[model samples]
Target: MELELRHLKTIRTIAEAGSLTKAATALGLAQPALSAQLRRIERALGGALFERGRYGVRATALGELVLERARIVLPAVSELQREAARFARTRRDGLRLRLGGTHGPLLGALVDRLADAVPDTTVTTCTSWSERELAELLAEGRLDFALAGVCGSAAPPDAPQLVWEQIAVDPVFVMLPDGHPLARGREVDLTALADEEWACVPGDGCFGDCFTVACARAGFTPRRMYETDTASCVHLVQVGRAVGLCRATFPPTPGLTTRPLAGTPLVWRHLLGWHPAGQRAETAATVLAQARTAHAGAAARSDSYARWLARRAEPQTAVRRRAGLAS
Candidate 1:
């Protein structure tokens, strides 16, 4: 079919937003014009590209298949445009980049590395952010890199728009009051605590749908009676209002002990999230590179905190002290 970059963008926008009207507002096109644009493309393809329903315009099977390839088209075109400009200003332009992440320790080390390695670059980072808000800001040219947890691998597969480079794997644990019953257990499984009240972030937030998947794999959906996407929920758990699921690497707060679930997969992945390709805010790549390495080294910190977590899933006395926590 005779499709172009704009058509591909229209499809991705509709898919991510789950509605034509919202995509229109984001893309700054009138509703009629957007509708006609999609219709013409589907005509060329000899099939409907989007399914209209109560929720919004969702990609048809064909549209879903097309999106796999189309997702990269726009980004490749944007990068091509920028490469020419970059070639011209190879040695003269300075990089001004902004990076954001919720997994703080790893990224903070990355920024320090970037400062030492790339003196010409200036990067500022933030932890504890909303993915939707961060994605919006990054798309609108406000931010560059995002250090989020891993996203699912359910893409159409042909397009291959994302790359997940794992920096570290940390165990999932239950955050409980200082003296909760399960606090002293070396490890506890979800099935064992099927009846405990749970506290977690909303489904759209970081621990969203994935939490349900993790719990399902553990043999039960959590009895999540509370759903506040903040650290305050940890406080709720502390006061006996709810219990929480947390990765050892992304602790909600102090005095909340974490014990591993005997048979669950580790849900903590430190991921470096970025646009596949786009008109980035100048210094995005340099910052992203630093982040990837920072997570690697932070994971390798041979120190007490690292050993301490290892101790939790085993007898604490088995951990041998490793120095170098300072820096």
Candidate 2:
């Protein structure tokens, strides 16, 4: 009822540690001072939170309750503070976009489309990231949308928080040793090595999406139960460590093979990250729609891309085309 951020932090620390002295140390406060604050909070709430026991301080039912609420409230409060800061700066007139891709190809395509479609809108890419970093940033309103491969249905749901838009899909392949079974078959289908053990890109990397999206397009999901994201141990097609269901663009490691799936549509699943806060102005929406159109057009035939631009230009033209009279 009457607690501040520090008070809630202290309460959470105490509940998590289960001892006043330990919690104080954890919270970087003197034990006596921490104890006094806890006592004051208990007085405000008219209930006891911790109990003095043989082992140490332990949570009473109320302490546990307070801690639980603090966990949920504190994070939201912190995010709100950051979001609020943005409002004070220029009122966000233009769109600030954040785009992410699993690898270089998609990244290139994304830029090309935005340059063609929304040339007037400002576009920005993150400094350095893996897949998970992109996901976190998008979820936290740091990105307008992330242009990455759809590995699985692990993305956040759209509604109060986020909106997911599917842009396109592509096929999958297999990377294996040159002479490996199925590798020599000219195609890397899932059934070719259904029971194969594998090395993987961490859930935070491009290869991670490659595995999942490729598996999904094959009508099956990959079983990547092992992880290794290291410098010298790049995720290339190696002789002993593997045969994975993915495309050739993956880290191109040595001693491995890359082959296409025979008849499977193992593909590149693309998505647009939509944040309500990031889409505040008419300019943002127009830019977003433009970027979406350009990417779609670029991925297809050039004639189609140009026609798509004409179609986009029609919206503005039609209004002008009809402004004088019903022509």
In candidate 1, position 113 carries an lDDT of 83
Q: Please, what is the whole-model Cα lDDT of each candidate in the order they appear?
A: 0.64, 0.60
Q: Write one digit per residue (lDDT tens) for candidate 1, span 184-234.
A: 776676777777888765433445566667768778877765767656767
The per-candidate count of clashes, in order, stands at 1, 8
| Candidate 1 segments whose C-alpha is farther than 4 A from its true place | 1-92, 102-109, 116-120, 126-142, 151-164, 203-210, 213-221, 275-293, 296-327
> RMSD in Å for candidate 1, one decimal?
9.8
Tell me model 2's lDDT, rounded to 2 decimals. 0.60
Clashing pairs in 2: 170-267, 170-268, 171-266, 171-267, 172-266, 176-257, 236-253, 237-256
Q: Global CA lDDT of candidate 1, please?
A: 0.64
Candidate 2 at residue 93, lDDT?
A: 62
After TM-score superposition, what is the CA distance of residue 104 in candidate 2 from its true location, in Å? 4.4
